[model samples]
Target: MDAPIRKHNATDEERFWAKVDKSGDCWTWTAAKTNGYGVFRIKPRNMVAHKVSYIWAHGPVPKGYEVDHMCFNRSCVNPAHLRLLTHQENGQNRTGANTNSKSGVRGVYWAQGQWIARACIGPKTILVGRFDDLGEAERAITEWRIEHMPVSLRDRRRRVSGPLADA
Candidate 1:
């Protein structure tokens, strides 16, 4: 492995920026990653690159809070694209649907021949609403998320595909 993100002579802030690629809208980490997230190893332990970036730009992450990629790019270390969120808020902005989801949308699933809309916050799953119409189920979940999640969810459209495309 290359030298840890911090080396003896260089300041932590200076050394950290050296490995970032800022050519695009999202600044990406150019080095090592773990589970799709960039890792920066220093003396004590390995710190997430985006977390380091957020600390440098903003401040320390509050107790019990996590750093989230507002742009949905896991490798992005751009401070502008990052925000602090509670674990529950972060869970709300999942990047994609689960493998079992046929609707191609998260939180909306089919059960018992009707559509179910639910939001999972950690271990608990809250039912938003249910509808015979798939679109109505989707809309119910989406609206519930927007109103309830602590962080702002991306307002972009979700692509509905597979069996749910027509509905």
Candidate 2:
């Protein structure tokens, strides 16, 4: 006869850690995932692993704030790399431009020999400005982000340098 599937009565913490692959920087979850993010069952409902980690480390996520992966790894369940952010803030923190984008930078594109910078807030798209140089376009986008987006949404790794460093 085939062996029966054994079910161990593990605690939430134990169950949570048991599925984590601690070998990597991300502490990647080895359990079921949806859209690259880890999913866990908590009796009546399914919960996201990173959210569970956040709740375990801190308290429940604040109202209107969703858990965001600071490392940008969807499968990461490390509490240290998680933060609660508003939807708009989370969108602002997104990395990389669309694959089809000719210009490498997000929100800045080359048109008619000039680099045009633009930004979207909700449904409205605002034209930041047009510049002759790529660096200037980048600076314009950066400045617009600083002025409009929250500080938490800004790229933490980006060091302040170049012409807009003082600004």
Point out where model 1 deviates above 4 Å: 1-8, 122-124, 150-152, 155-167
Evaluate residue 124 in candidate 2 and report its C-alpha lDDT on the 0 to 100 scale: 82
- lDDT (CA) per prediction: 0.81, 0.83
**Candidate 1's error at 35, in angstroms?**
1.9
What would the TM-scores of all predictions be?
0.80, 0.79
Residue 96, candidate 1: Cα error in Å is: 2.6
Q: Name the top lDDT candidate.
A: 2
lDDT of 2 by residue, 1-167 (tens): 99644359868788888889988788899989999999998888999999999999999898899999988899999888899888877888877567887888788988988999998876789999999988878777877877787643444345354456554
Worst 10 residues of 2 by lDDT: 151-160
Global Cα lDDT for candidate 1 = 0.81
Candidate 1 residue-wise lDDT, 1-167, digit = tens: 79555565887777778889999999999889988789997778999999999998999999999999988988999999998888877877777679888987778888899898998777888988878988788767766776776463552334243332444
Candidate 1 C-alpha error for residue 155, in Å: 4.5
**lDDT, residue 74, candidate 2:** 95
Steric clash pairs (candidate 2) = none
